[model samples]
Target: MADDKKKKDDEVKKEESEGKKDADETTAASSKKKDDEPKKPDVPPVIAAGLRLERILTVSSPSGGSAPKAAAAGSPHSSDSATHNAAALTANVEAVLHSNPGKIVRRWLGTSSGTSSRATLADLSKGAEALLSHDGPCATGRELVMLLAPPTEGGGEAMDVDAKAGGEEKKDDDEKPKFLSTAAREYEAWLISLAVRLLWRDGRHGDAHSLAGKGVSILSAHMDDAARVTARAGAAGSLGKAGGASGLYPLLSRMHRYQSLAAEGLAGEQGESARAAMRADTAAAHRMACLRRDVDTQATLLNLMLRDLLNANQVEQAQKLLSNSTFPDSASNNQLCRYLYNSGRIQALRLEYTSAFSNLSQCLRKAPTNTGLGFRIAVQRLLVVVQLLMGEIPERNVFFTEGMVAELSPYLKITQAVRRGDLPFFKTTVAQCASRLREDGTYTLISRLAHSVVKAGLRRLNVSYSRISLDDVAHRLGLSCATSAEFVVAKAVRDGVIDATIDHAGGYVRSHDLVDVYATTEPAEAFHRRIAYCLTTHNDAVRGMRYPPDAYKRQLEASRGLKGKKDDDKTDEEKAQEFEEEMDEDY
Candidate 1:
């Protein structure tokens, strides 16, 4: 009992000691926390006050109200860093614009406020003119004029939807910009006049005339002496005459001025009134020829004369002038070839086939390769027709050399289809060639002949070829025969097949032997046999006809060896070539 009581006392003492240690540790930790805490700086009251004032100013409005209402008005959503950044950005832009007035004005003009959401060309031109005036003399005026000019494509019309919708669009009553009227608008009328001259130089006569006329009208209305003289000189120059129209001498030159006007009238337009204008101009040019030693004026007179000759089809005289003139060699060659080709076409139209062929052939030989192919093909086709008309077969095989077979195949296929009397085939063939050859009429007879041959073949087979239309074939192929006949024929004739022939009567007929051969088992094989026989026989005959007895015997032996070979090893290409050689001999 005594020992138990002692142990309980010791345990109570130990508990008291642990509680004291824990209390001491808590005090030390509190002291360390206080020591590690950051110290606050003692800020000056005035500086603090100034910072508060700035914050208050930013928060407050002109009415000296609280920031809450302004902040809510500025952004109904809860204010964040993004809103503050946006406000900063806005302030920066305002500051920039305030600093640079010119930049600000330029930006304003470039934006919708100056040009409007839908600015017409006239508005743009007006604004551009104002900008150019403010900016002082530069190329800006010319550049602006060019920019305000309508686009060349789409009939030179505005494409902007907004511009098109506005009532400010170009009006029917609006006269073309003439030089005289425009010149009255500003001292820069000379600039406009110069622009007109440059436009004429660039072959924009319509624009030049319009602008020049505007300038003239403007200058005349204002009638300042210097302006009048300048405008009159500009007008004369724009009209392609020597300038200076001032005093008694100038008045005496009134007859020359009238002549110049007459010449202008002739080049203007062509109709009943135009004819009268041309007559007046002709009289004036003749009179000017008598008066002025002006080389340019005299040259213009000659040009007018040449133009008249050309219009009358008196090409020989015009051509003589061209030949004698010191024109560039390339230009001369091109002109000569064009004239010859055109003359040939005229002869063709008149059914002078021989003359047409002669002219066209010469044209082809002279024309550059790039330009020549089309003309060459055209002449060749015409020659083919001429040959046909004269009862002479065209040597088409000459055009179908190994190098040109791929290109010529299409044309030949078209011819074959036409000969076959396959109208559907011919139509499809024509559509394909339409892109390559301009004139379908030129090949009409050849196409017809092709159709006839196909028809004859069908007739001989007792199978109406017409019934097997291209449409039916297209359906079977699961595609359109929008393909060229050449493509179709190439596929058809690839294995030594001649679809038809032009008979002596100019009608197409199927080669009966070919049809019979195709009707046999494995037609390709049978055709090969026929080709071999024909080639061997042809070669043998040629040797017999041309060679001495000893050479003929040797040739015969070789020919026999070729015929005896029944090997199926030879390719289709080899067989086709062999057959072609045989056909060449037969012809």
Candidate 2:
């Protein structure tokens, strides 16, 4: 029995020793494997940017097909899908980074919109967040690029985008790529712009402005590189249409605008100093736009400046801006609508009621009917007020426009008071809706309508009585005194508000007999005016009609072809005629 127990203990100890030996062998093998596997060096930011850009270009390329759709957020496979995407992107980057930056920029700009699809753009942005998250030492675009470009290689004059691979074999001559300084600078500028935009979107306005300024400097460097290339190539004239850096101008202009806007946002809406800074930034952006001949950006900045001035209650400055620099008639409809609206407001303030009404009417007509309900409502409200100030009653349906009845309610009350000649009621309505009027930015303009209210009262009195005492006029029209009432009636008569005469000596006003409209040319003249307006509108619409993309060009090409064919046939006939005449002469 003792020998059996000893044998069992010996067997258990041998089994435990065998298990320990196997575990020791496996651990040694794993440690050896880990040591043998090379560690991945950290990706430099510029190279990483190039990689992301390449991936984006590939996914957005027409021949590349659509990128793999990402799994919905929070799905179990979402993490897996993201991992797979990152791996795929790294593979693409590794495969393509050996090429020069010129090839990469060419590929990038070759895309129709200069950006990838939403999925790929998002992926690239996520990668950018990782690469650009660092704040110090390598902050600017040039610094990032310099890291990838070794100074030993002629101060990065011919910086290739590829990171070093220690053991890679030499590539064939055809496979090897040449470096382009211009392309490298362009790539740097693009990365900076992207970073700045992202920073701004993330509410880091100060950082965004700093990065954008860096981008501007990079763009300047790119322009210098382009000029050098042009001069070396013996290209003539200033950097015009054929300038190598022309493609980067748009990017540069956008950077300027973005930088200015970011700075403005950082300046906040508090002090005069902030406003001055904002204005200075805007002026700088406009000058850049003008230099680049970027008309769209110019128009946009003009409208922005005008809005800023108006919001600051600097009406004179707004007018000077409009007068000093004409708003481009070739601007977009939305921009033109805004310009017209601003011009109308200025005109109203100047008491040029006729011009104000004309501008406001045009603005209302030009404003989009289906969209921009707020814009349409604003223009419509101002239009009604201007019409009243012009001594003309607005049409009843103007107040009840669809999508605007609720907004125009206050204007409707003002209009009712004006048309009814109720001076006291008009005063009450203005007081009650003072806050709303101020909010709509029409308080000052509405104050001028009191004169219109007086004129309305005179018209009512003209219809009601052949003559009335000045004291009665003061009481009925809510005037402060009989002298004020007499002065108002005299001005109204001189302005043709009512066919009445103010008898200052008699201290009363007398109305002329009502004329029959059908017996006069006024009705015919009004009808003719309406017809002319309708015809002009129709003609304008016909001229302004737009064809689908390329449709007009196709039509023009087709017409030219037919005309050429006709000319060819005519030339042949003329040749035959001349040949017959020569034959007759020979005979």
Candidate 3:
């Protein structure tokens, strides 16, 4: 029975071993099948397109702790793939940027109330500095026009010529450098502007101005580039030879208006103390040449500077600014008129009546007809007084200009009262217009015309009577006393308005013999003056006229147009003869 038990145990052991071996083989075959069937693509099968944007967006914690490990474990081989991608992306981004590339910029970047935001802004600024460096393949100054140039015009056909010359090799050589240049140029401008805004916000205005100053060349280039483009393309039709001046106005206006409204609101919110702070800030900004230059806000800067100079009574400095190249050439009609008007006002203040009259007249001529009523009224009001001061009466038609009736009513009364030598009427008119004059801030200036009224009254008195009592003169001219009347007579005598002598002891005025009005040797002095003025005007017109750049192009077009009409009458030789001189200039 023992021998039989042993035999059965051995057989059972062998059967068990066999069963285990079979099970191992079956497991191996199934593993092979799974392996052969493609093991569920462990690493998202290396993408065909190398630059996958999703890689950038994917956030992975550097710490790879329990949770990440757990996640990795769940995905089998996914952790390896993720690690590979992360490494590759880091390498690529590092290679694209500088050795220490710094942080990437975003439009809505905000400070974290920490050092991080500032560091990022610093990084962006550094990048801009790198771009602006001459060593880089960056576009500089007005060369930006190449990027924006019309397809039919500059550089657009360069690609084809390049392709025909060197096929793909030269293209490959040229394209990379070109792309780098463009990327660097764009990044420089954007980063610089970003840095400026950031610095401005952080109360680093000095730094901001310094940085902006460096980019003034680039900003001004944009203006010149735009003007050239517009001129070449005839882009802004009917805007005239003002070039890009009118085009710039709306943009500048909107920017300034928004800033003003914002500042005003801030002052309103913060009250009186804020106003002084705001004014200081404004003054500082206006004085920063770079900030003003970069944004093309120098026109406003110039105006502010002029105001400051005038306030300081630095007339020479203000006049120097007016004559300087730094002064913007008034290209827009509105700007031209305003500039003239301001010049006129300043001259009037300085008692340069002739220059003031000329400037005001130019302003009126350039100003929009039936519009700019306020500007016209202001000019006319000052002009009427200036004319009277110069011993001239403005024509009646001047008061009847379209859209100027109501506005000039007070001025007309003043003019009419002066013309008729009615002293009391003049005084009454001035008193009645006192509120309006004060409102216009011309009360002091208009009051100066009161002396002119006295002069006119004395001249009339001289015409009516060869001699008159000083007391009677005081009564007629509405003077307070006989001493005032003698003073007025002496001034009139000195001015040669009315030939007169003051009898201070007898308290009477005596008039001298009147001379002939037209006693000049040549054509009357007035006629000679008019002739000289005409000659000067002609010379100025000649100096001011400029031929357009596309004059030759227009001539060519004209020639073509006339070819249809003149073809039968003239030979090809005649047309060629006329255009030959122009063609060389064009070339």
Candidate 4:
């Protein structure tokens, strides 16, 4: 019985082992089937095509890292292909070139064996049209037009041309060759006009003018009778707006008779020529009217007009324009102030010191800090001169001691260095005073005068110093030393009443006689007389001790005798010293 039971167990174990082996085999087969299964065929052709076109059309680069896969797909034309067909076409084309170079030559040059090469405008135009029609966003069309366009004199060669040929082309070559059909040239003109119009809208007036002018010239050259008139008128209008009056006027006059004829022709209901002329005239007139009406739109125009008036010495006209024009109040102030300041300058030039002072002072009051500097200096200049003329020591001294001289000194040096023509220092001083009074400040009056003095001094001497001595300057002017030397020097520098210098010996170096220096430097007999008259009138104010009338007469005679004498024959320094001694004795 035990033997029989063991046999049964062995049989059961063997059966169990066989069942396990079968299950293992089945599991292995299933795993192998999954491993061998193909990946789902790539994205559908239509879907892939959509993604590629989207990438090409959009401004940004393609995302999702799918571009490579899409590119790998057969040409877009092949519904089932996994790569781009366009790339394949390009590759095929390249391979063909490698294989048969002569084929490309034959295709491009037009003959089977090549050698016939005449590029016409029609060909270029057709190419441009085709490029523009393309759905791609590439710059093919615009770039082609730019490439065909003629270059400016200094402009580099066009990319389409051979570099060597580009350098040899004449500047006038930028124009389309006469061989080009008029219609083709017209189309080019239209393109240029469109570009200029776009630029104008973008506020690039300079570029717009350049391009518009070129287009207009071309249209005028090649456009038909009717088209030419229209083009001329359009170009005139654009030039007027973009380049202002200077550029527009010439074109307008050239088209004036054409415009009249057009108007007359239109009244008679003439043909296209007359009608086009009429249209051109109408456009030009519209542009002119628009320019006139919109004059206020450009701040530059108003500013330039005001500046021109000032430059022409037309102060009244400038003032009138400033007062009548409707400019932004804030902007108008700077120009208005400038006008007023200039008017004051004119008054001072006329020696109307009081009127000059008023105008400048008013301007100074209204001007901003940055703009106020000029007006303030003007006021100071006038005050200094007026004080000197009136011999008001206290007032003069106030200007000198107040640090006004320091500010003006450097400017004076520069003016002197440049050797600008003689300007009436007194007038400038009066102008400065008017500006300062208008502005209103404690130091305004003095500061302006001081700065003016410095400017005038610089113009005369071209050297500035930290301090100047009034006493030494007075002595050089043949006047007794004043209590405030700084004040005298400031006055002298401001008014051009005297030329003063700082000596190496720590004293002020000044001309001994105003008339003598004026005569020597200016060589104007009239100026010399004026200096003498001014000096004689201010003799008492200058604080020089008066000698007896006879003694003065003798000195004057002696000076006249010394005139024209050879310098080598007479000791000028000794004579000058003797003259000083005589004056000291009289004092």
- How do the candidates rank by TM-score, highest first? 2, 3, 1, 4
Higher-lDDT candidate of 2 and 4? 2
lDDT sort, best first: 2, 3, 1, 4
Model 2 segments more than 4 A misplaced:
1-124, 127-271, 502-507, 516-587
Q: How accurate is candidate 2 locally (lDDT)?
A: 0.65
Error of 2 at 492 (Å): 2.0
Q: Residue 440: error of model 4 in Å? A: 27
Clash totals, every prediction = 34, 0, 0, 37
Tens digit of lDDT per residue, candidate 1, span 164-277?
556445655343221111111222332343345445555555555455444444333322332234344333221111211111111122223322233343353432354444
C-alpha RMSD (angstroms) for model 3: 25.1
Whichever of 1 and 4 has more lDDT, that candidate is: 1
Please give the CA lDDT of all the candidate structures: 0.42, 0.65, 0.54, 0.41
RMSD of 1: 31.8
Give the 10-residue window scoring lowest on summed lDDT in candidate 4: 108-117
Q: List the candidate 3 regions with Cα displacement exceeding 4 Å.
A: 1-250, 257-301, 304-326, 503-507, 520-525, 532-536, 548-587
Tell me the tens digit of each residue's lDDT in model 3 across 354-426: 8888888878777887566787888887788788877789998988877788888888898887877778898
Candidate 3: residue pairs that collide: none
Q: Candidate 1: where is the Cα deviation over 4 Å? A: 1-331, 370-384, 397-587
